[model samples]
Target: MGVVKDWRDKELSISEVIRKYPHISPFVIIKTDVQRRGVNYTEKALAKVDPDIHQVEYRGMFREKGDATPVSLILRDGTSILTAFSVEEGKREPILVDVIDDRIVLVDQGEILEEVEYWEKPDYYDKFTSSGKPMWQIAAARPQRIDINPNQYCQFWETPGHGCKYCSIAATYNSSKENKPKILNVDDIAETVEEALKEPGRYESIFLTGGSILNGKELLDEEVDLYIEILKRIGKNFGGKRFPSQLIGTAFNEEQLRRIYDTTGLTSYTADIEVLDKDLFEWVCPGKSARIGYDEWKRRLYKAVEIFGVGNVTTGLVVGVEMATPKGFQSEDESLEKCLAEAEELAKHGVSTVGCVWNVAPGSVFFNQMSPSLEYYIRFADGLDQIRRKYNLNVDMDNYRRCGNHPDTDLSRI
Candidate 1:
């Protein structure tokens, strides 16, 4: 059984939560809830998808069973609902996707909520790199961003109990026999980006992230070198010194960060802390805690602000992991209070916090663990957005357009 409780008896319904937080965007709330409780496509709904136009192939960190499924859904207001298509261990049922009036609409309990569109495949998605690798396999596309995961597997999972309990990167990579290239060829990535940029206003920015690369002369030196090489190649396309880009890599020392900043057109940086509470972090992400420690991770983020500038440096939190049973906080109130307090502290140091709703995956250690209530997610996102506003920080790199995975950053558009 999942750790999530029957919140219907304890908390407000989705409509009630929206009613209470009237200031929050109803579309964002619906997106958040849809992400929290994933979606299932009916036969008619799946038929609406055009594999050539709509994104139907799996790329990046996660892998699905078949060759195709809608990559993700897009709300009418340009809000991207980036979620996996999976049932959460029978803990909760996903909302239904059905065709209504020749449009795809999300259905809950037989009621149509809103119309949604599948993410469209970019022009480069069907092309092949000079190296004979499919360009789509090398890079993935969002509504306004081109995502490149050069390093697919994290080294932290090598140890018995090191990987983050809530993460499924290692499992996904291990099971993916077809997607074999672990680290992307720099030339292929550059070629893919060049082709993607030719699609006449299809992409706005480039985003890169992957599992932690722990091997280096000094902890993450090798990892830093890899990004510098990739960024330099990607930078060749742009004539300017810096292009609109973001790298969500592991926390590196000042020297390592400066190396990438000085060498490439990389614009923004992020190092996900995963969880705010130190104790819970150690329990949930033992590898991260053991390799870099919680305090040092924050220090790296602060140092990144010095080099990358304020608003350009951010940290992501797997919100609600602090409520994991046994090791996590016991109550939602306690978890929310503690998390926001820590987020506030980071914001004071010119670091913004972004929230990614925790959807316990089957491959994760916390697969059976339940996430927090929908109310908790709304309050958490609100708190993080308020913190960024208080600090006068901008999350343009990870905002609604660039990377729409975070609910907190999604608030930046409004």
Candidate 2:
């Protein structure tokens, strides 16, 4: 594949990307592009959204508003395209979601790409806990998983310039005044999970992830303790010692890893490396690099495999950040080569790599930076997917059903 000189001037469309990568799902390609360029609803499309039936309010830590806009869209094959439209200075124009022929469709450059449906609201979204806090505010839901953010604030931003360049956690946390609590009550979380489980066949797994918690007796010990407490509380709902759960927390040492693995019903573990290259890792995520060097982070992931077992432990990369200007690799080919090489090394140690298309979110340091082209993401997702297959790895915990964010993991469904 030839690299385009200017990403904006490149004429290669989603249809072309699908034709080039025939084996990769077209739905997956569409999901990647929609995520890369966020979506905005047309007046007609917005008219189609019913808050009673469709999920509208923003429920996660990322977005502050609980506005009645469509939360996200779902493709025909159950693949999710997660997007948020926040009006901010220097943000890219979103793709249009308009009504075509009496059906909702995605329009890009005056082309009707595909039909899409709004994500249905989960049953428990409307219910409130005994403490009068709305259950939906405590835990958000995807099509097949429950997302809980136990800690909403990340300590990395407390430092002058330590937070990840491609993250908007602190900005989003500070902007909104939603009634949701900063630190979720354990009982509230447990109660919400118990209520969510009542909807039979609705949820396949439970996912827990949040901003980095740097304060601890040892590094990330406080973060580990928080997860252990929440996991134990949620464990009460299950009959066995373990349940279908995944925790994407900070990279912890062996002792902290063992504490969660041994005590709770958590099944899988993940620590997002963000960017694969060592120098880029330090530049993109200075907080993580300063606290836990890139090499040590990889070491912790390997140790997690020993504790969580092969196919149960994984690391995530924000796929396109390696191409950010000034410090990132100049060429897409060089970036992909170095990234896959590092990912392959991790795969050898029983750690699988998943890709989340980097959205240059507003308020992030990289807010004005451009993400790589669509072809780059398709190739990146395919490369990571192929690596897992060669190693005979399974991404069930983060696959399409459990967590639909990763295009590489969505390929595992096939």
Candidate 3:
């Protein structure tokens, strides 16, 4: 195990640790720490934001980086850290991104760690639709992809105890004006995609994801149909050709998967298993287990690869959640072993795996729970990366540039 750097107390700097793990990008390590602890802006940092050019007060459910604040920061290398705006009680001392001496840099106790740059606003961000809806609201642009959320509220949250333990989707949804509109208008989505595509060479892929839609002819028929409609609409922009896209939704059956593929230009599919271990998944994601069952969920993922094709479909796992207390794996070593084994099983069937570090948010059931150590995460990322390589599966859909949230996928670049 590597020595834990006392970066918060300034006892040991992250820069020192970066030298130790030369295999992992220095930017990634910093991004992980910033995300794990969260960030706080100094007055100087906030002052650097430009409302007109940057995305500030656009109508959305979540807060913008800042009016003049850059949407997100990029390190010396092109690693993106798209953090949410959150200020909660007892939070750790977040790294401060400040404009010190006319240069935007990450500072801790006035120690300049690295020069950083804000994520540039996309070309279409300033454009508006003929109907006057700001294109940014219609679709949120990432470095290499466009994000579309069809529904904001997960019905599981409707009941007192059915929601997942580590989710703030409903809380975040309630706060957004765009999501407050409830369901996404299919016409609006089609129109927005049409306009967004006008900026040539801007976007490499389009992705659609949303909260669980439990209503339909079958369990997720309604959810499946909603995507089918939107996909068909967006397909117009691709001239009926399948574009690079992924749908991170609830696990759908073979029938539902086929229907979606036959109807739209979607090329990749993802159904986040969330937690790798079965018992932890049951307790942490009660709604998912009760509705789809753990075995069925994995089955659907493998089945999706059959429909979407291997290298084109994958399942996401919340990397640290397997260690959640009470029913979770007792040891970090055990958790990593189990998660990698399961991932390999899925990979053998042509279903790739991606992992995102669990962010223990205030609204989650595991809010008070602590995540695993950084060393544990690094090992887990390394292990999962090996599994993908062993299976020879492709993860271009959620790789570093496309998604940027998955540490395991991030390691794929190595």
Q: Pick the candidate with the highest TM-score.
A: 1
What TM-score would every model get versus the actual structure? 0.95, 0.94, 0.91
Candidate 1 C-alpha lDDT tens digits along 277-377: 89988999999999999999999999999999998999998887899888899888888888999999999999999989888777889888877788999
356, model 1: CA deviation in Å?
A: 0.4
For each candidate in the order shown, give its overall lDDT on alpha carbons: 0.86, 0.87, 0.78
Error of 2 at 81 (Å): 0.7
Q: How many Å off is the CA of 346 in candidate 3?
A: 1.4
* Lowest lDDT 10-residue stretch of candidate 3: 1-10
Regions of candidate 2 where Cα sits further than 4 Å from its true position: 1-8, 58-67, 85-92
Model 3 regions more than 4 Å off: 1-19, 57-69, 85-91, 175-179
Candidate 1 global lDDT? 0.86
lDDT of 3 by residue, 1-414 (tens): 122345346323467657767887667777766666566677787777776555444323355644344556777777777665433332355678888789988876678878887766777777777767777777877777888998877988877788888788777777655435767677777777777777778788889999998997899999999998898888887798998899999999999999999888899999999888788888989999999989999999888988999999888877777887878899888888888888888889998888777767776777777666666676777787888888888899997677777767777876
**Residue-by-residue lDDT tens digits, candidate 2, 1-414:** 121245556546788998988999999999988888778778788778787888886445554333467877899999988775333332345578999999999898899989999999999998999999889889999879999998898999999899999999899888867754557899999999999999989998999999888888898888999999999988888874799999999999999999999999999999999999899999999999999989999999999999999999999998889999899999989988999999999999999999998877778898878778889998899999999999999999988877888899988788
List the RMSD of every prediction in angstroms: 2.5, 3.5, 3.7
Q: What is the Cα-based TM-score of model 3?
A: 0.91
Where does candidate 3 clash, by residue pair? Answer: 49-68, 49-69, 50-68, 61-176, 165-365, 216-222
